[model samples]
Target: MKNFSEIEAMARMHHPDLDARLAAHGHLRTAQEIADIPDDRWLSTMTRCVFQAGFVWKVIEAKWPGFEAAFDGFDPVTVSFYSDDDVARLASDERIVRNGQKILATVHNAGFVADISREHGGFGRFMADWPASDQAGLLELLKKRGSRLSGMTAQYFLRFSGWDAWILSKDVGAALVREGVVDKPPTSKAAIARAQAAITAWSDESGRSQSEISRILALSTG
Candidate 1:
């Protein structure tokens, strides 16, 4: 793969204001900041990402207050114990999206978050302790343990929750292919590993966060 500077130059060619755009995109939290985030917020973000999947994000955003109310502020300890009755009630509740499966996913993910919080003292601590270099491993863990947290959903959850992460957007995937990191958008385990390695190497060389590298890759493609 080419050096990250070369990739950045290509991005600048496409968008001359790449740096300013990147500065406004989003900020990565410090480990301390991440460790201080409450478990409820983690659960809330996770549920939002789950619900946003294959659905209209603007609608979700507009009705988010109802979602917050309906899910009991996404307190992991409370939502983790939601029963079948609770599921039925949420499904019938017009305040939220009312998707039964997604509601169920919220319940499952609450337990997932609560369990981690118990084990690690706090879910934020668990996330803070996870090394950024192994984001693929982190994503795999989310896929296996958290409900509806596979693929881009999991990536967005991590990103939105202030975890240092890279999203595999279409443009980023295209740029990866251009760099010969993978022959296609990385779906298979092997392909994803290759892409991760390429990004990790670029990060080491460029001293840029993975999210920034991801954005640069997307910009470079256009």
Candidate 2:
């Protein structure tokens, strides 16, 4: 396995300029900072990632107020029960992005939020209880339970919601292969497990957040 210092050095070599070294790094939100976020925020972030998956993120961000108003602040209980009429209405709503599939995903994801809330007393509780080392498991739940939240969408949801997530970006995938962790971007459970194990070990050895480790790895091959 490659060390964090080795990865950082590679990034530095790529950047070259002395000041560029510090400019190339990133950080993660601590669990304590993330644990107390409102349940609605979690749903909102998930929905945003869903919408932004194959679309322009800035367009979504610019229209987010419309999205908030259109979705009733993304209240899980309220959204989970959205009627057929509601779906039809949102399909034409000019205020928010009008992608039918993504709009419908909001309703489906609302049910997902409600289920987690019931299981954990609230989605925030689930976030607090979930261990970062087991993020691979959390990814599984997001894919199976959350609507449209598979692959990078699931990862971006966690990352945007302040989890110290490891993104399997193309560059990060290359770094993984270089480090002998995996031969390709992980798709199956076993592949993801191998990726997770290597990341967890790197996190422990480097004392870095998964986000930082992910960035370092991605940057290593850039």
Candidate 3:
């Protein structure tokens, strides 16, 4: 398998088209590199994923400000305190998803965020206690948390929000195949090694955010 630096050089050569795809997705950060985003951006991403559960990210991006306003900037303290009337208003907002179920889930998730915050003194702390630094743990957490629009894809989105440290989802590996970035290598250690090399290279130069990487990787791979 190629080392990371060599892979980076190869990927940089192929990065122009990849970069275009990510820009179309509204990605503004580097891949798998979430060290600079602030707390509010993280919360916004979480809330936007709630809206984007079954929808497209571009659509969500277009109405993001509406979401921010409807959810009171995704402030757990403010959103968790939403009244029934507030729910009704949000559910009718045309600029947002306007789906009652998704709207309620966002409210419920806000409260859930509050609960996790109390239990661990902060939601970030709670996420840190998660076992298994892989997609399986993310899947189990989504299932247990009553996430309405969550699945493997959604879990990956959560991981992109800095909720996890790695992208161990099958979809992530499959993305390499879709992009023809890697051969249809066997699903053995060798194949995984090739995929990891591709990911490291892609992450280094594409200037895509993790969520954008997840989206493009999954779509292209599929």
Candidate 4:
């Protein structure tokens, strides 16, 4: 693969405003900041990502307050204990999207968050402590343990929750293919590992966060 600087130059050539666009997204949080995020908010963010999957994001955003209310502020301890009766109530509730599977996912993910919080003292701490170099491993953990948190959904949850994450968007995947990192979008274990190693190496060379590198790669493709 080419050096990150070369990739960045290619991005700049494609979009002179690349840096501006990236800056508008705001700075990533420090490890301490990430660690300080409350467990409830983590659950809330995860729920939002799950619900937004295969659905229009604007609709989800517009009704987010209803979601917050429906789930009682998404307190993991509370939502984890939601009963079947509660699920039925939410399924017919007009306040939110009322997708039964997504609602159940929220309940299960609350348990997932609560469990992790118990294990590590806080879910935020667990996220902060995870090494960015092994993001694939973290993704695997989410896929296996968390409900509806696989592939792009998991990646977006990490990004939206302020974890230093790289999203393997189509453009980024195409860039990776151009760099000979993989012949296609990485889905299998070995392919993903190879992609991860490439990004980790680029991070080491460029001193940029994986999220930033991911955006640059996407911009380079256009």
Candidate 5:
């Protein structure tokens, strides 16, 4: 039930030399900023996060230009139409990572982006319209609708794309447990709900963005 100021005070206690006042987390984008993003860029970032999951990020970074070229700049409409032949081609393509499952996930997630775009005028609009207070709901949508977006990928994509969100990284989870929000990492539906509620309560109590809260908690507990 501690507010952000209290947590920040705790953080300052932990690291006395560093100023503990919450700076805006650099990674999160404002709603207007996120709304201005193109659908293609969204798809591209989503694809990158998907491929980067459980894999070396620098390797993906090194090959991103090839990924962009191979996927035709991640045009959602274009990639949504990729066929079985395209899957086979990408699987053997040296330009990008050769994981078959991840390659197919790109195609599926492209379709997901297209669907959301059509439903909400654009994917950017869909993202922009999502209330930050209900970030867990958006994460659930990503998990149910998108491929290879389970666990941390969706959160990473959100941060990378400038959407404000809390990343339940291992450190963040530990921080949550440390705060008595839950006794362990939130895995089951009930535990996850408890975690989200704890964060939402903190957001209300502190009037801070999820990104700031996440970093503050990480600093204090990690």
Candidate 6:
């Protein structure tokens, strides 16, 4: 519990003043607060989040040793070739998330990744092709990939990977309110200054990716 609390606090500290805006609108959110991480880390983190859909980060972080070992450090070329036998093996691997469905999706997504690479050069290139400034196209991609993971819930995971920009609605919003980043009673003032202060402080110390930040925040609230 203590460790979880610390992780959550770390997340709160990483926000770029966006939380108050979300809160004012009755939403929960995570945003692009990391400006120093390399592009490759962003790609790999996306693949990792796909693999970790329903699992805890501590579990994934601990098992990351084996995940890196098994998946060739999440090399898209290597993971894209994962076969049915590979899927079965991963389903039983105790060191990883081990969920059958998620394991299969990870492998499947790898194939899609390979296609994206072949047609566009690489995942990063594909990302560039995405119209970040266009909401409908972005949401379409989100919904398409999101179909595999219980409606748009998977969209949040994608957002963590930096593939999309999104805000959390419903329960996650309630969770944020409980975290004390915002007052539940509501007001007109923006808390962006406080939230950005927290995020800047947290970002300077941790090398973890955006999704990791979100997990840390959720764990803090949990």
Q: Clash number for every model? A: 0, 0, 1, 0, 1, 4
- TM-score of every candidate: 0.99, 0.93, 0.58, 0.99, 0.93, 0.52
Question: In candidate 2, where is summed lDDT lowest over 10 consecutive residues?
Answer: 18-27
lDDT of 3 at 107: 75
lDDT of 3 by residue, 1-222 (tens): 334334334444556475565456443333324434443455666677776766787998998888887777888767778899999988788879888887777777777667767776666655555542233444556557745635544555555565533343566565566556556632444564555455545555665333554445544433
Q: Candidate 6: where is the Cα deviation over 4 Å?
A: 1-43, 142-154, 171-222
Clashing pairs in 5: 29-162
Per-residue accuracy of model 2 over 11-31 as CA lDDT, tens digit each: 778755523543344345666
Q: How high a TM-score does candidate 2 get?
A: 0.93
Q: What is the lDDT of residue 92 in candidate 4?
A: 98
lDDT by residue for model 6 (1-222), tens: 123336555546664443463344322222322333333454356556666665676777777778777666666656668888888888787777777776666665666556666786565565656543342344456446532543234455446555433333443344445556555421212442233233334444564432343344543443
User: What lDDT does candidate 3 reach at residue 216?
Assistant: 51
The parts of candidate 5 lying over 4 Å away from their true place are 16-27
Q: Estimate the lDDT of model 6.
A: 0.51
Query: Clash pairs of candidate 2?
Result: none
RMSD of each: 0.6, 2.0, 6.8, 0.7, 1.9, 11.3
For residues 11-79, write the lDDT of model 1, one tens digit per residue: 999899998999997789999999999999999999999999999999999999999999999999999
Model 5 per-residue lDDT at 70: 95
Clash pairs, candidate 6, are 8-220, 13-198, 13-199, 14-199
